[model samples]
Target: MNPRPTPSPFSPIAIGPLTLKNRFIKSATNEGMSAQGVPSKQLVKLHSALVAGGTAMTTVAYCAVSSDGRTLPNQLTFTQSSLPHFKALTDGVHQAGGLASAQITHGGCFTFIRERSTKRPLSASGGFNKIGLMSGMFLKQAMTEADMQQVVREFAQGARLARQAGFDAVEIHMGHGYLLSQFISPMYNKRRDQYGGSLENRLRFPRQVLRAVLDAVGKDMAVICKYSVTEGVRAGNSAEDGAQIARMLEEEGAHLLVLSAGMNAESITTMFGSSFPKENRVQQKNKIIALAMAIQRRKEPTVEFRELYLLEHARKVRAAVKMPLAYLGGAKSLASIEKIMAEGFDLVAMGRVLLAENDYVNKLESGASRDSICTACNRCVAMMYTPGGTSCVLGQPGDAVLNSQQAASR
Candidate 1:
């Protein structure tokens, strides 16, 4: 038998012009700490904790390029009013010895548009987001050519704002059936214009956005993209399609590719690990959301726990693209990270594990823990929909009640 390959989590790797001390990144998971479209002290504390805990890079997630693109009322957006807040966030990360990345997105029909826009939410074609619809979003409009151009400009402006705020990287959100992913996924995009129908056409808008971001930032900051390997429906993009998408992103100059799976409507659990506890919903008291969850669970259900769940699919994307790839799934152990490194992935990102144990990276690096202690209970996932922002419920149970109440008040 061949010898086992050595693991290199501590090795330095270049993602564009930024050199990370280690391959571990705290992948973007919205903390819900932003209110009034700016980062709060709580957001600073969250980023500081992760950086202090030994993450080489920490991603501030779900900053909308435009207000109408916000999926949550408290979500951050790139705007003149929010500049100082973002600056404080990146400054804190840099001081803590971790590079900062901002994940910029346009939520499309997935957002609460009435809060920010007079016009209807835009999509490749008009349709309702089941979750949003249940939450009172009743109408959507297909994107006109001018609307698409404006979105591309919005992404570029977001990147420019990220650079001004001192971020080392900008992660363009093209996954999870968000704006760009909605255009890329065949199940959602039903337009017959030059921007839809065929796979290449479906890629057109996303490509434009990617190009605009690259042009805006150039070599001043790294550009990364998150995209799905599968949209997780009967008639969605498959792994082969993912490979093609990866190549397309590399061609358009993505410094790194974050390979994830699942879409918003059907298979959200696949995008993030889910063992959603029922008590969480009861605590939050949102019946419509609970009903939607029930419907989705009955239809697609949460995928069972497995080590490196996306590794096989990510390998397909790796072979297809020449850029550095970051692996995101249920990686909670050094052993899993080693296996991923041995397979030649350039980076490993953790979401739930980090949410559960902020110092997990330090623990693994010090050899103090063999694996993360997170149970994947996903009460934290429930909390995101609540007003508590996000906190691990392992040691503090009352946090659930307090947080849910706060969310209701909001």
Candidate 2:
């Protein structure tokens, strides 16, 4: 007998040397469940539940390559000390019947400057970030050649560590205004070096990082890149540039391209899904910074919710590159998911909806209701800053009660 063919969306497919069970990936959403740059039991439990709930693969989000590279102090870091915890997390996910991926990241200047005091934050250029300055952080120092090469080495080392930790794949975060993203976006990269002139120059460091990661991991595990298609603001990466970037990533031997957009400093609301809720905003401890956030929040542009919001943009990327493309954006409801899958995207990456409904893929498989109940209110996005970690406010009613009870006791 012949082997079975892969199904669309539900089909098992090969990404590099790894085969995912289905075309559904739990996009890298901040879990805020780690502690002191180490994965906790809570992190393990979260990924396990997501895997058991029917995601083909659940990604461990925002694992930093180094201590100072983190956007938050509590993020997961791939380091000698963190090895066991990461291994446990991946082991638990695999035991739950899903492939596991780690999203390796470095926040660059956006690494939350307030967290580090010994040295200034690193950026592609030595300059002030308006958002950083507004938050009382001084100008970031430009990355020296040594600094750049060291970071590339860290990325490669992170990938190798992920493979050792039992991850089926590693997703390089090359988007969302993180360190790699800063080098790619002209908005933050103003250097005059080989790493910062035209698009090719802007791509220099990212390509180097990708090459190093590929060399480190070889074909042992899949290597995917989560990249922004555009910043969705003037003077940022345009659609054309995004397409070019996707093509470049393909040439660099990336197994998959997860296309997303928006620069946190540019139009944060676009990346964030909806307007930043005033109620959920963590009151800045510093008065000046609190005032700055208040002013910026009021001025932020809000994008209305639309099904498959980024499908068109992702389609452009699909056209540009032959590598497997994962489409991310507003994918809720059966109609929208089917629309996204039918558009030739190899996978549909869900974030907020999965936060709202962990078993959505199972629901799809079981011939149950086709529509997703997630409201996309984005309150969970705010919970990443809370001490309790990210939890759906409306989706999990029991969590709400537990939180309220905890608050009352405190």
Candidate 3:
């Protein structure tokens, strides 16, 4: 039996010009938690907690590129009005001893679902998003060449704004059925034009988005693409296909690849939601397993992460590309981090665990592995949809925001 490779979570990793103390990241989780499109005091407290917890870096999470992409009323947005807010958020994280990043995003056809959005949802092509369950309700407007060009411009501008805000990195939200992912997913993107059909054509929109972002930010700040490994469709997104997409993105100037599962179907079982075993078929396991095995058996480590179950994809991506990788979702303990490193991954990132236990990094670094941390009940996730702020329901505060949303809705 080969000695389990060096623990990935403890390894020092370089994300562009930034060198993290170790390979643990606070996966970007939108706090629903922000205030007026900027980082909130609670958010600063949260980042402080993550830094004190000992993670190498933490993210600002969910800084929307446009008003339409803003998921929650208080979520972060990158318009000129938000500059000071972003600056303070980044400064707080860095002061806490963690690198601060922004997962710059756009909602596409899916933004502001819980709210009565003024802007209409846009897709690569026309189709209803559940609201159109009755054909008539499934209303969707296909993207025109002009629309595509406009989108490319929007993403590039978002990246440029991220740098101005002092973020160490920018993560393009291409996973979990957001605007970018929708453009790539066969289930969401149905255009017959340059944006759809054939894998290359389907990928054009994402590739263009990446190029635009890179051009806007250059190499001054790290640009990471958070892509779903599967679209959870009968024949939509696939792991092998996803990695192939990763290869293409790397070629197109993506600085890092953040692999995840699921798409924007609103199914609780997609992406990180699959980790708790609360979900039936356990979607993320297989592809992540395959990807990890391929990377482990390789002679060189091309990709840079050992992140969640997707260590598999990271591995395969590593073998295929010379870029670094990072993992996200459901990592709650030091033991798990150690295990991922042993498996040869380069980093570990936690979303809810950090929220429930902000000092997670500190505790893990202090020799208390995250053995029994983060209940993952998804109360924090639920909080975002509620309004005001998001936190765990069973958490210490229970559900303040939930109560607020309830009161307001009433």
Q: Whole-model Cα lDDT per candidate?
A: 0.81, 0.79, 0.66
1-410 in candidate 2: lDDT tens per residue? 11223246777888899888888999998876776677766667677888898899998899888877887656678887678778878888989999999999988888553766336788888877665665466678789888989999999999999988889999999998898999999888898878998998999999999999999995798899998898888888987899999989998899998888887666766675566667645643435435544765877865667777777677788778778888888888777777666666778899888888888899988878688888777777666555556778875422322222211122
Give candidate 3's total backbone clashes: 22
Candidate 2 lDDT trough over 10 residues, lowest sum: 401-410
- Residues 78-142, candidate 1: write the lDDT tens digits: 98768887888888888888999999999988875576554567888886655466667677789
The clash tally of candidate 1 reads 0
User: If ranked by lDDT, best first, what sequence of candidates would result?
Assistant: 1, 2, 3
- Alpha-carbon shift of residue 153 in model 3 (angstroms): 1.7
The local distance difference test score of model 1 is: 0.81
The predicted structure with the larger lDDT, 2 or 3, is 2
- Encode model 3's per-residue lDDT on 1-410: one tens digit a residue: 22435754655777766778888777877665565566665666667667767777787777877776665455678888778767776777788777877888877666434443333467777756653342232465676778778878988898888899888888898888777777778777777777788778888888888888888886788888888876655657777777788788888978777767775443324455543221212222334223322332242222222225455545555556556666665566666666656655566667777777777666766766546456665546545544445565545653344333311122
Instruction: For candidate 1, list the clashing residue pairs, or say none.
Output: none
User: What C-alpha lDDT does candidate 2 achieve relative to the native structure?
Assistant: 0.79
Which prediction has the highest lDDT against the true structure? Answer: 1
Off-target runs (Cα >4 Å) in candidate 2 are 1-7, 113-118, 282-296, 397-410
Q: How accurate locally is residue 388 in candidate 1, as Cα lDDT from 0 to 100?
A: 54
Order of models, best TM-score first: 1, 2, 3
Cα distance off (Å), candidate 2, residue 94? 0.7
